[model samples]
Target: MIDLAHTPVTSVPGVGPKRAEELKKLEIESVADLLGYFPYRYDDFRVVDVAEAVHDTKVTLKGSIYGTPSIRWYGRKKSRLTARIDVNGVYVKVVWFNQAFLKKKMKTGETVVVSGKWDAHRLQLTADRTWFGQESEKHVGRLEPVYSVTSSLSVSWLRKTIYGAFAAFGREIEEVLPQKLRSRYRLLDRARAMYYLHFPKGREEGVQARRRMVYEELFLYELKLLWHRKQEKAADKGMTRRLDHEKLDRFIESLPFPLTGAQRRVVEEIVRDMADESRMNRLLQGDVGSGKTVVAAIALYANWLSGFQGAMMVPTEILAEQHLRSLKELLAPTGMNMILLTGGMKAKEKREALSQIQMGLADVVVGTHALIQEDVIYRSLGLVITDEQHRFGVRQRSKLREKGETPDVLHMTATPIPRTLAITAYGDMDVSVIDEMPAGRQPVETYWVKSDVWSRVVEFIGKVCRTGRQAYVICPLIEESEKSDLQNAQAVFEEIAEELAPIRVGLLHGRMSPAEKDEVMRSYAAKEIQILVSTTVVEVGVNVPNATVMVIYDADRFGLAQLHQLRGRVGRGGGQATCVLVADPRSETGIERMRVMCETTDGFEISQKDLELRGPGEFFGVKQSGLPEFKVADLLEDFKVLELARADAAEILEATDWEEAPEYRPLREYLDRFQKEQAKFD
Candidate 1:
């Protein structure tokens, strides 16, 4: 049997400690790890003749190398060798590299089969592989598998180890899949799959085995997610607060302008959801400048009328500050008390804010992730508004709800998601979309120009600043790197500041300290800085009405949604805003991507296309706000599977929640194991 404890790799016949260390680099620590290392390729050698072999040619020829080889040292780094191999009706030269000792093996004419590359120009043979075996030509059977190898590990040792492991207890590792489930899922038994996958008779069988295993892995992962959803629903707290429309109506009317059609529709939905008893966990998605903040403000006001406090959580301190200011301005006429709690707040100011919150003095609390911190409790928090929902996790959302007795949640996203995605990703929650941009919100004009047009681009920003307006210049990096050609925020900032010496300009990047970032952003927002050069840190929540020009350096490096977001930083004022995209002619695909931003300003269209092209991953998401990130099932392609799984989970819960039903025992065990694995491994 393959001894899990004592069977060292070298004991399998060839590998020693030095070789074992090499295998360990490939994550092959034990006999099992080595056995499971699969191949990425296979080579078939079925046809070959000895005499037909020529120099500089790779052929599988049945031949014999009888003459001793001569090795010649070329340079400090190079070596050469030559030998005589007798082939089908002819003789050929066999060449080896740095193996001068092979010269001891010649007696005029001994027979040995060889396989190597043919050098046609020099009429020589370069060894790729060679063997002296029983067969001359007839059916040596199938192709040899070629596995992925690192510099430290060789394919020969890996293959030998797997075969050695299999020789012992190969049958013991076979899957224990239930017959009914296997037949239903059309899956292979684990043992049979391992055999075929590692040593298939042909290509077709190997492919079939791979498909079966991948599908099984995905299916089980999907099934577990559905089970978790069931547990959540069964434990639903169901705390709904009645929102008075007139209380919110007064607050809405207090704003400078009317709500857009999209905003009104979302407001009605939130109010309706809050009006009922089911806890409100809804998503509010819309494009830039779609008026989601006003909708959130009105919702908070409704909570005030319900005799409870409200909380607004955002992704960053800058965004939290922006919301704090916007809510204060929007609700000032209605006399709502809005307070801010961020990481950078003064100790005494934060203490006062906390005291005010606990005593029900602050009507609405707005901040970054700090809003959900312990010791900052509310007397009776009825509503929780999370902006940029993808930035936070599901557990974080639950924690926020824990801050209250299951407070109603309203998630906000400036980047819109597709319908199928909404249904699959946020399957358990209701959705509201602010599809229409507010009236008089002029679309920002865009330009895609080559780097050769740099002079003209600088002039455009200057002209906008000369008109007493501000502008934003964006770069993708913090500093130039030897690995990349993109411009950094600091270099661009310095360059632009010198280029436009008379204008007040500033710099901001992710590496800046939190206090420094806030200070710079504060200056830019207050128009103390007429031009701000930044990285994608400017990708969200900056409201500069006077800034009408946005210049993105290396525009093609950003995704479509990201491009749309950076472009959104402009065009918030009465004058026409311009967003210029600078790129090189060589980046055709990148220009095509940025065109989405130029062609349409809708976050929904761009997000939909992006989701279609690149499915759900860590790169784009709602965890930033307080939503869960999916691991296996895609929000776009496998949306239907999600719906089916969700519904099935619901039915299972209704029949027997918390393992109250005997039929759910298997699934429950699977979930328990899965959770334990994620916790331990991840």
Candidate 2:
């Protein structure tokens, strides 16, 4: 038995440096990595008669070649090797695309086994894989593991490499779970499970092996989460405040508009959490235009009433300024002074703001990442709120929280994550959702228009502007990238300005300076600009009640949740609003995505559809949604396993601390190793 982790993949026979580099692309660096690289799917080697094979389905057939395989080239780049196999008395055509070398290897009258998709449309079998030899029951009557491959690595190479590593280190596969727990779960021993998972004799064996592996993966993940949760609990004491209901009532009454029921409920949750002995680590999720800012303001006001300082951090300087202004307007009656401390501020201005913040002259502070700089000190920071929470990574949020002694943290995001994913991603924190829209808010009328209908869309925009309302034209790119065919913000701005002559059109994107962006947003809000051409940088914080039209170019490129958020830019003032999506996608999925945009305005519904379409990895990946990557446990397909792992982890933690138990030493060490590896990625 060898140390699998210390043994590199290159040590495997036939895996030179070149092959090792290719394996590295799949994150397989060691013998242990190779063993853990589970197969994505399995293939059945049970041979069936050619006549019994169903069309459009994968099947294996064993027969002898009736004639020599011939290479046919449809074009200079298009070619296929075709052969006819004799099965009993029926003849089935087998085809392999672009592999002309198969013609030389497969001889007439030679026995072969082929597996492929039986294409009924062409009445031919398009071979995905093939083997040449006498059909033996050992290889033809069992299940085979099929691994995901790269262009440089073939399935056969991966299989051979894994087997070679197993031969060398199979005995070193240590068991992390205790024997008693394994018996309770009816799980196979670690070494036997690996063998059965890689090379199983039957479907049941493969299924059981996979189940065992899935449980192990999810159990380890849940256990780590439990550990992290405990660490958060044991952190230094946090702000424990008393609520001033009279002050809250006066603030609520002073507001021009009433808070929605959902908003009120979420605010109550925040207030309750803030008063608890433990710190309030809560995530506030809401759709666009749901008045999340008001709820956040109320929370900050409560902290202020307790004679504690509060901070709100946004992703962009434009957003930070916006929050500063809006909070000033909302909290004017409370007589609390709030100051802005952004990186864009001049030295003199920044010095003054820092002095005020440090001396407790500023009750509330709003800024970008500059608020977390080492030089910035708080007099008595009690509450920390991060707007557009997905845009900030775990490190940034942690840095801000470190400013105070376990400050009550509140994270807010307009990006509507699905309920299940929210639970999984933010499992360590409490969650509150603002599901209801504000009163008198109207649903934006949405439409899907083809690119060819650009003239009509322009005409509509002009009409809306002529009616004294503003419009937004959102392009997917700041500047045209060679890889994408979408319109850029500058190009679209020029085109719209020229087409709609005399109409003041402003441009905004991420590339612009923060001051420049603020200028454009201010102009747009003041109605000095009738139409605004921009990128998704305007997706979060800018608000204008008069903007009633939203035209998104290449809208299909955006997820449904984002498209919904863009639509939310309009219809803010209870007037009729319209959202036009310009796209002409070809795939059924793409077409369905556009259709979903036109069908609903509910952010949660759109997010659910987005999750179903993109899965958890892609959904979280689209934005900087901070979630730990699980190696084998899928939040969707293995959701039940996740639930089981969570429950089991709670029970185990209640019984004993694994680190202190002699029998659980192996599990604790394994968990430590896993946490260290996961931290490298974070």
Report RMSD for candidate 1: 7.0
90-131 in candidate 1: lDDT tens per residue? 677777786655556544565555556876666566765555
In model 1, what lDDT does residue 442 have? 91
Tens-digit lDDT string for candidate 2 (498-519):
9998999999998888789888
Best by lDDT: 2
How big is the positional error of residue 352 in model 1, measured in Å on the Cα after superposition? 5.8
Clashing pairs in 2: none
Instruction: Name the weakest run of 10 consecutive residues (lDDT summed) in model 1.
Output: 624-633
Output the worst ten-in-a-row residue range by lDDT, candidate 2. Answer: 622-631
lDDT (CA) per prediction: 0.74, 0.86
- In model 2, which runs have C-alpha deviations exceeding 4 angstroms? 1-31, 63-135, 148-189, 240-261, 343-352, 373-375, 393-396, 423-428, 477-485, 498-502, 615-618, 622-631, 656-665, 674-682
Instruction: State in Å the error of residue 542, model 1.
Output: 0.5
What lDDT does model 1 reach?
0.74
Collision count of model 2: 0
